[model samples]
Target: MKTKLWFLLGTLALLLTGCQSKNNSGSAQQLNLMQTSDLLSLDTSQHADLPTWNTLENSMEGLYRADKHNQPQAAMATKVVQPTNQGKTYTFSLRKNAKWSNGEPVVAQDFVTAWRRSVSSKAQSGYNYIFSGIQNADAISKGQKAPRKLGVKALDKHTLQVQLEHPMPYFNKMMVMPAFFPQNRTALKKFKSHYGTQSKYLYYNGPFKVTKWTGDNDSWVLMRNKYYYDKKQIHLNKIKYLVVKDANTAHELFSQNKLDDATITGVTAKELQGSKNLIHEKKAGNYYLRVNVRNNQPLANAKMRQAINLAIDRQALTKNILADGSLPASTYTAKDLSIDPTTKKDFAQETTPQQTYNVKQARTLWDEGRQEANLPKKLTLKVLGDDQTITKNVAEFLQDELQHNLPGVKVQIRNVPDKTASSETRSGQFNLSQTLWLADFADPISFMGILNSDNPQNYGKYHDDQFDQLYQKAILDSSNNQQAYWQTLRQMQARLNESMPVIPLYQMVESHLVNPKLQGVLRHPVGEDDYTRAYLK
Candidate 1:
């Protein structure tokens, strides 16, 4: 799933409208915030990081945005419509009042243009996979069909129609994703290749507009969009963000009142234990180690991968290193994403052989795998991770645990910026890539599809014919048989546990020191927080 921007929920509208008049006073409504990383791209079709999506969600309006309770709510669309043709066909009537920052009316063709570009063969859009169930999308993505043949069209100026290959139960929830947002053809044609790389090249339709962003700058600002249809409900005049990767630095900025909101973890999170301003948000994402199993790497051996998985102490890492209420992960999927239709059981909580911490067993397996792969007794491997303080701490902890458990193995920790880590991992430049996935929507497929043998996001290059076959079966059953689909998912996860392509680490819990005065800031379970309804009291 492509990373999405954190958008304003519908439920906050009333509260925001009530406080709108009071916030008009100069400088009082501005909210100072901090991000662990800088924005990568403004283009929704290209960005795969959280910060970039967060910025886009604030700056662009989609067909439907989430309500405060995480329910589907209409944004650009006048109302959320029911799917026709057995849940395959959808017709949306967009709000006529909506206009782009450039004063161009947001028509249905904008969506068509963006959707077609995403599935075009030449684009190589990492997110085009999400359009799989849409008619002709798969063919277009594979270059078998033209982009214009994909099953989406603009009926008229304000009407958009979409045809799906199958009945997608979670399709409505996907409308809020950044990839589903419309693109201005005028801007695309005007800026050409430079489009979405900088803030100036894009047009805004959401509550906020990107006023200052140099694309590579660590500091940026979002100002209220005057052209937004619901501009009257917007309370915050400005949202400023500064990249502060160090937890200590974030806490210091928050303490000095330089930042109204700061994400703090590790020692800083532990220190703010009982503070009134502390907000603990358990995110619906998992952090795992992506093992490079391609080209006969040491991790290509299943036994070697299992040995590595068994050697890590997840409990200590989450409690001691993270100290942010994150749960140790036993599987690839995070908790609460889905429930079995028959048993009503949570997908992540379903019983399966667990990932255990057994140093003795790990050591024995390591030796066996080494001999089988014709490797030396002493081996060295490098682990790539983000340079953020919390991530760096986790990387260092993994190094210690692996080296300590496997006597002859030597581990090296390489810390780089988040963008660099993502780039390197995508290019298969590391033995082990410390990465994470924030689901685009709350479905098992969103997480499971990443490890698909042909998935672009499968940075580790792990492949298994059996796993891919089983995963395809699950996809086939998704629209027809819920029970069989759920069972297939369980089986796929079991297969993952056996292969150990990715080491399940922990389910993240974002701990933030948000100013008490900054009311109405909505923190979502799946993605980043929204500041559209926020106000400095």
Candidate 2:
């Protein structure tokens, strides 16, 4: 079955809300943090990366926001509003006290405007597909219907109502996503194409406001928003982020005590183990290789793809090379997140399984793949990834493993900047793309959506109609019958193991540095930080 668009999340943010860190270091009100890449776009509808989303979650207030437990909590709205129309329709009572950093009142109309603009024909919104669950959103995005027909409506200034085409179980969690964040039409129209192009073009309504981002600046600051409804709960006066592309550089900053937090990996991770300031958790995502089987490439042969998946040593990569809390990922969806409805047992522990690792079987498959592609005995393929230190090391390690395990195969590693790497994969310019997907919401369906045949996020174009049908069946069945839904999900994963379009490598245990003095940074596997409640001890 075709899945939905998958969002690639790189590093999970390290917030100091509930972390049990020792206080050996000095305290500071402002937390100096380091992030790997520069912000791509602040526009929620266009930006897809984790860094941008994290920034948006801080600067913009959605109808709901994520809590310390990664559950949806009220932010703009008064509470987690339940649905009507058999779990398809929802009415939100927005907090009248909420206002933008620019001093404009946040109303239901803002959400209406943003939702409509995101689905409109000319919006060029990359994330519009996320709105498909809402009524008429699919039609509006397809241009089959007008934006006005969208399910969202403003009953009055403070009240908003939404009607979904179907009962979307994850709608509550999705409300916290950036796409669901409200946008002022006045600002959108005033800025036009330059909207969110620069920091000044956008308006902030959450815990912080953007100040020093010139759109292309490598560094920016988030200052406390006085107009925010819950500003009293916000502790930090200023949160500064500098884009340090290299992990070693970030590590150096951490060593020098220049940054309060830094995400360390590779050799640096191995060295920092058992530190009092380190509070690590199993990250909620998987690293996988997306084989572009298009253009008659050797990977187009299922045997070739299977050979590649079989050859990799995931255990060594996670333990030796990564040296982080990351574990070998047998499947794309991380274990422990999704449980079987019938057995109430962990999904991965119970039913889903990974393909075996055997060089001999891999070689045999490789030979068959060459024959299937009607190719010569020898072939060369390029593997693509970002230029991050860990990314390059992983790519190199894979190159060595694939070349060593499978004969007649020469592998080349193509490392580019983080931004360009994603663009190249989406544009179909690479043979193999190193990809990752953190569950957009806390569910198996969130991760499964990436494997859909025609999904925009499926850059590899791995299509299986049977899987797509089963996936849709799961989504539909989930509302009425939970048992049937879990069974269907299990079947879908089984089909994935057979298909082997995307080879899962690991489910990373998130690693990071925290200020010993920084207290109460709540650790979440997904969307893992809430600096609003963070305080310097």
Candidate 3:
């Protein structure tokens, strides 16, 4: 009996030790995620993609950030401002307690420096057009004026004022974008050309600070900022991200418990439909095809563009190819992104149907286009897209469908790196390219503005006077004309589709496998992921 009791006590001690070991192993307070793509730049003005913006949003904050209910809430600022002087002037008061990771006070001058550089012509910022409503922004972007002349000023250490060229009703929401983020002037001057190019060159005022990204590295770390204004509420110690472009690899990592969040695409999304970890969110964005008309003989023909658009079976792509809950976009702007001020109806649902999948119609249009352009029936066009799994799947699908539907046209699918694809598309180096745009703010104009003639992002070189005029009129109407505003949006969308400069493919839906134990991770379909309050339960 004595021997048995001693043995039992030894067994109990071993069991307790094993249990404690397991608990300690599982208690890591880090959130591991798969990054969307390579983070191109830390400078907010230098890049326009979601990955870069999301990185900036994580490490640095703007005046406002989206809350739990996806509504804009204050970040650096204490409150939202109402524009004075009949909506032409806006003023803000800063939070005195906000400080950068280095313990420097975050003041109003930081905002002034960021806005001027972002709108300057030297930055080649894709979003400079967004600042057109700000006073002297257009002139500054044109190099006709200097950054000092910009209408933003720091009234004091805490007070900031802005003068707008026009009365913009939605200007408050625009503050959420990274372009409005304040950059540390001392840091910028210290790093010179090296600033925002590497993780070490930047400072953080948000919940986290970036590290280990040496300009072009695929992996990085977002460590919790001790100096963060709300650091006391932050639960996670660190957020680590790895650039796993392959969906299979990402899913495998998640299955092995190596990653807390993993994005899945193609058949993977379908197979994981009922899985406990599966999560899907409809995106506020659209993927479209831009055809370069310059030096591209076939693209100049409107009939050719129409034929290409008709050949695409968007419904089949969204439903069959991508089993995710993506929408078949008839218009360029996404659903639920914009609403009529008065009617409160979604603008995406109200636009007229622009294109359709008609094999017979596509073939007829192709023949007509061949004759119209006085060219041979055989046409060879190269299309550039990302080399990742889902994008490759889509490119192959389009190549097969377009060739089979349209007679004698062969599309060579060029798989390039994400950055290469973006540069080539913007420079008009390819015959056709697939690209996507997420709204910087909740505005239909954010989507449509990229297609304008003078817009630098207009890679297709499409120009229409009627569309521009109607769009301008809609933008100028700040008196809450819901009926006129929505109707004008419809007309603008109709004009783009009629011109056939680009073909609207489908809206996006992202699939993720999130750890059930992780709570308050704050996943957004657009800008910035909020992780300050996120905790491992």
Q: TM-scores, in order shown?
A: 0.94, 0.92, 0.92
Q: Which candidate is the best by TM-score?
A: 1
When 1 and 3 are scored with TM-score, the better candidate is 1
* Tens-digit lDDT string for candidate 1 (163-206): 99888888898898888899998999999988888889898888
Q: What is the per-residue lDDT of model 2 for residues 12-103, given as tens digits with 9 covering 90 to 100?
A: 12233223232212123677876677687788766677778777766787988787778898889999988988899999999999999888
Model 3, span 224-336: residue lDDT tens: 78789986567677788888877788889999999998988778877887888988876788888887876455788888888888898888898877777777877778886
* Strongest candidate by lDDT: 1
lDDT of 3: 0.81
Question: What is the alpha-carbon RMSD of candidate 2 to the true structure?
Answer: 10.2
TM-score of 3: 0.92
**What RMSD, rounded to one decimal, does every model reach?**
7.4, 10.2, 5.5
lDDT of 1 at 161: 98
Quote the positional error of residue 196 for candidate 2 in Å. Answer: 1.1
